[model samples]
Target: MSELRTEQPHDDAGLRDWQHVHNVIIPTHVLSLAEVRERAGRNHLEVAYLDDVLVGCSTVRPPTGDTLTATVIARTLPAHRGQGFGTELYARGVARARDLGAETIETVVLSSNEDGLRFAKKRGFVEIERYLLPGDTIPWIDLRLS
Candidate 1:
């Protein structure tokens, strides 16, 4: 397997790459470039590649509030799943969250993505909630690391 390379998106092209992976993986909630830019300002957003091929993206929402909870989301293209891209991105997100003083780590997965749900569970994340966002049909599952 090619070594995964993750870059914090700073340029337009880099940002677009991140958006592509995110929109593709979560078709229910596609994000435009403007939205992605907005999110980048508030979160750590990154795009991942494997030997020059786009494979995934990640978001690390730094710990906030009295709970010091952070959200880490790793998204991999369907074609790239099971190749360790998600694993690498997830590890980096967790590390970054901890570095930012997270006392608890949480991840939210769209209920439709069985792979993501399974990945989070296997990593010791327990389901805390499963609910639908307003106007959305599919529910999202929120899991916290044990």
Candidate 2:
């Protein structure tokens, strides 16, 4: 196994890398190039590489409004899902959020994603709320950093 490395790619390159991982890991939820560009401008985007190949990606959005919480989202390619890549990406997000002075960290997972729920629970996050959106019921889970 190649050593895993995480990096914040430059704007244009990061968008392409992020979109590629998004499309591969969760095709149904893949973001448009425009959305990827927007996110790169608004969040901390990290791409994980195993040697020279992109294997995962993460986004940690800093708190906004009156909230002291940061939001994290990560995805690893299906071929790499159970190999700890997702966990690594998620941990990086949490660490980044803490470094940014966030008091809490949260992630929203679709109701049907058992693996995501399990991953959050394993990381000490607890389900706080479940909202039924247009096409999915998503659970909001959080972990306090303070």
Poorly placed runs, candidate 1 (over 4 Å): none
TM-score of each: 0.96, 0.83
Per-residue lDDT of 88 in model 2: 83
Candidate 2 lands at a TM-score of 0.83
What digit string (tens of lDDT, one per residue) describes model 2 on residues 45-98? Answer: 988889888898998999765677898887787777898899889888988988
| lDDT of each residue in 48-90, candidate 1, tens digit only | 9889999999999999999999999999999989878899999
Best candidate (score: TM-score): 1
Which candidate gets the maximum lDDT versus the true structure? 1
Model 2 poorest 10 in a row by lDDT:
137-146
The deviation in Å at residue 125 for candidate 1 is 0.5
